[model samples]
Target: MRLLVMLTCLLAGCLAEKPHPCESPPLLTGALTVSTQNEKLWTYTRFMYDALGQRIRLMELGTYENKSFSHDVLALFREATMYEISYHNRTCKKKPLKTDFQPLAIPKDATLLGQAVLGSSSGPGQGLLVNTWTGDLPGKAGKYMNTVTEFGCIPIATSYQTSEFGWAVTSFFNNVIGIEDPGLLNPPDFCPDAEMMDSKVEPIDFLSLFHGKA
Candidate 1:
């Protein structure tokens, strides 16, 4: 009947979900757990990100080839320099930072995969809504899939796979909206005495460092 068809159309419209575009906060501090394909590498990283300022600091503790190590890295994109400090060895290495600053925002060309609730939705404040997106990396170097909160655009998890390197997944947690101390981005005092590497040498990719490349 015509009346039945009309009600079905109304119900379909009400059930359809609309996707919204979102960008993460310009500044944030978070903890990340990164793992590569086949459990080849694993790392726990604490990071302070300043997307607007084109800078980031990371303290990474990782296990690779059954060896555990810890290090700190400060990447200054504007200055095109990166400082890697090894607390255990009391050593520092300064090298060029060749990669451009990739913002935390979702790419405009990203495709929305779907929306889901992270927890029980039986009652108010019971669940967290999130959206998943997928897109190509810059220069078509790789592909990435990421998930973020539906409300504040806080990142939940991201995965990347490239031709040169295998896939890696990073899960974000304990994310705070803003940096409590800007000084955290500054290189340590010992960085001034760091061994300066040749600028012409091939430099490590800033983002790849967390992927167990370093």
Candidate 2:
């Protein structure tokens, strides 16, 4: 009888579910390395994200077509506008930003794939716990797998595929909790004289902009 009771307790413990982590914070600053299969491109980017203000800014340095290029992009989702600026040439382009804002949180419908610790776990608090989730993008646009910290829900890595842009993997690092400089979200001074591009085109995949497609 004692053996049966012990077995039942162990089983219950094994079956217990872990608590869900909180969604990502509204404001964040981070650096991410992005690689795209179709473009055979690699980009190092530092980003400032302000979910409350519906804005994001990216400073990207990358190699494309066997040459180095750098740009800064300011995306204003609320205004449906994007500004791409090249400080090297003192040029800027203002175009329609058709992509909607996607929060950092895992979707409600995401399937939990697995969980693991990211570093040594020989002692208490020795490593970071993370969860992996997979899901189809809305409207069947693509598929994505994300790994995020279990406690803070901060993204650690993401791999996704889209029909238009193919596959891309982004690894996040040096993430800070809040935006330190609100001015980072502002377009450069040259943006005021930016060329105004036509707005009659179809919506583009947001990632494509990084590939120099925009």
Q: TM-score of each candidate?
A: 0.85, 0.85
Question: Cα deviation of 29 in candidate 2 (Å)?
Answer: 0.6
Q: Tens digit of lDDT per residue, candidate 1, span 43-103?
A: 8999999998889998899886567867688899998888887767767788888888887
Task: Give the total clashing residue pairs for model 2.
Answer: 0
Worst 10 residues of 1 by lDDT: 205-214
How would you encode candidate 2's per-residue C-alpha lDDT over 1-214 as one tens digit per residue? 9999999999999998874634788999999988877776789999998999989898899987667888688888998888887878888888888889888888888888988998878999789989999889888878999899988899899899866547889999999999999986888777877766876654554785675567
Clashing pairs in 1: none
Q: What is the lDDT of every predicted structure here? A: 0.83, 0.83
Q: Which RMSD values do the candidates have, in order?
A: 3.8, 3.2
Q: Using alpha carbons, what is the TM-score of model 1? A: 0.85
Error of 2 at 175 (Å): 0.2
Ten-residue stretch with the least lDDT total in model 2: 200-209
